[model samples]
Target: MAASRKVAVASVCLVLSLILLQFYVTSLHKELRAKILRAQITTFMSGLISLACWYLYRRLLAENHTVLACPSRLLWTLWKSVVICFLLCAQVTYATNLFFITTDPQWIAMVCYICLGTLIQLVCCLLVCDLIEIGLRVLRRGRQYQQNQISLKAQQTRTVVAILIALMLSARGLTVGLSPPPLKKVTIPMTKLPRSFDGLTVIQLSDIHLGPTVGRSRLQDVVDRAMATKPDVIVIAGDLVDSVVKKLGEAAEPLKQLQAPYGVYFITGNHEYYTGDVDAWFDKLRSLNVQVLHNEKAILQNHKQPEDTICLAGVDDNTADSFGYDGHGEHLDKALGSCDPDQPIILLAHKPSCAKRALQSKYNVNLVLSGHTHGGQLFPMIIAAYLVNPYYVGLYRVSDHAHVYVSPGTFYWGIPMRVFTSMEITHITLQATW
Candidate 1:
């Protein structure tokens, strides 16, 4: 109970930083940058040192240095993370226009004085970061995590990923910064689908945020899991690659290795829109024999009879702010226009929030597949997902018109630890209830 209160307090303080930063930006923009940057640098250094300590501590456990990895080390790590909490508060406050520096906290005076004070603060912060880090470890990992024998090498690899991401983002919130991009597999139920193909499984892997973070090894693991199911069709939900396909082009080889009786297909995620050319990824997936389904469309046919079909629809990410749309990325009703409404339809939507409209439009799409959440890749963020996507994770019957399944995802994005959650390679055996 006491610990819960502390976490709650920390969370509240963290949120307050945002409110404060909003004020700082609108009013004290000039004086705020230096103070904030100083805070950031101090936080960054603490994070680095804490990361190093944690690396050593975890590696020690891996090497049977459990005894040598004393409570003291844990204490240091905890202290650092706590300082991280405070800095996160300040940083968010500044980033979001919440800070209101005293009108007299002048740049000329504060810059010089703050520079010297920052130096002193830096030294003190370093010590505090170390102590806080150690204390956090003792309280969190050392205390609660009684059994800790896992892969040291994997832990190290993930740890390095964590540190690099932290440095890149200056995020000390430390709930595992970002999650691996989600894998969306289009599961089309073949049973009773005029296809006469019963229990046909389609392994859908989508939004594979393949970037500096998502590498070949993890992706190959995804392919292996997908293939393990012996899918009849493999449908990529969309946003197959978040950034340049270059980092994951070689990784695409594994995707090419994917085998299904039917075939593999891909669509687009909004990330592809913002970060990479969505059309090019479509071409890339096509080169690998994975059909790219844009607003146009495709029909999933059983090999035995081409006439037997499951109408499949794919669209650009559906967000209220998407550019292609007059407002919402691309409307499914228009995207799926010209479809045979009588036949069952499966739509690949990147953001699950579009479910309400899909139903409202009378598209009558029976099953919708989506995977933007990655079950909050971090942790509490899952709650945020609930704000936009009520079907945050797993299968849910939102209404008579739709059954939506949100894959928790196979790989993680920024930070690899899936605290309270497990990565899923959802082999949804699309079934006809009747």
Candidate 2:
């Protein structure tokens, strides 16, 4: 009952938000406003249908009705038919775009600027409008208490301010989203780190969602930046690409240029499993000279002092098992079991939450590199990201002997709007605490 109530409350909030968005569109140009309204309506209907299907499934499960003896049988059949039609239409639309559309870099950039930029701007505008309205109400109340009329000039000024603020934020977000990620240098002092391995620089790149928008040029820029750092090791924590190997293989070609004295390593992220071609991606990455770490460890030793070594272990994304991919699951034990307990270990996990799990386990992990949150990727959403992840972004000291560094991401995903957060190529230098 509590769960049901929470769902009901969430549904109500979603409906109200859509209504507000609909009302907000009235202030937009006619053609754009009409298109946005249509999109919103379609989205709302799809969500409603999905929710109804889930509710019906739950009801049927609770009743243990294996046979179609219930009155909802007919309704269930109708819903299934509608869902199938929707799926078919969606597949056809996607295929049409994929085959017919030319994903030129300039074209993708323009689309992102027009669609994603506008959407973000509208949301910012709505928020600013609401704040202005509240301020006006407060001012009006105070004026009324003093027996004074609210001036039209004051309201007009507030409106203009709101517009300017929204525009500035939107512009900044677009610039940040489109630009190459900046370099972030971090020094981590480890008590157990071998002196021979001191000053070991590792370049960490994560969440480089190469797809239609993030093409070869963008990836090349990232590769150049990482190489410029002159890193001893290069590690991609997770979420390397959004599309399948066939679609993004060319875009990811720049990765082969990455060179380090140690190696370039990669681990699976949740997105890899979602692509349903995890093995294919792994093979592609391996072909690019990237060592795909599947719940495994690599012992790194200094040539001068072979005895002074550190363990670099990587586990699969925590949610990999849920995708039903055979032999793909996060096994921290498998990753760290063979490592020498006396040596400092750096664990690579896609999600920051895994840092806590590693610390709790018997493994003596000195640091964990991850990047799944994308630092919320946008404003307001960052707040929710903080609530969900153990470490939202930046460096975190989880324990006396352990630290976690969560990169914002190498590239923006989906909407391509990054506000109050930046994409980064994290350069970490290991310092001996002796």
Candidate that scores best on TM-score: 2
In order, what lDDT does every prediction score? 0.56, 0.74
How does each model score on TM-score? 0.57, 0.73
Candidate 1 TM-score versus the reference: 0.57
Pairs in clash, predicted candidate 2: none
Stretches off by above 4 angstroms in model 2 are 1-114, 131-161
- By summed lDDT, the worst window of 10 consecutive residues in model 2 runs over 94-103
Model 1, 110-186: lDDT tens per residue?
22222222222233333444465456456654433342443333344444444344333223222232333333444
Worst 10 residues of 1 by lDDT: 95-104
lDDT of 2 by residue, 182-260 (tens): 9989998887998888899999999987754577888888899899889999999989876567777777889999999
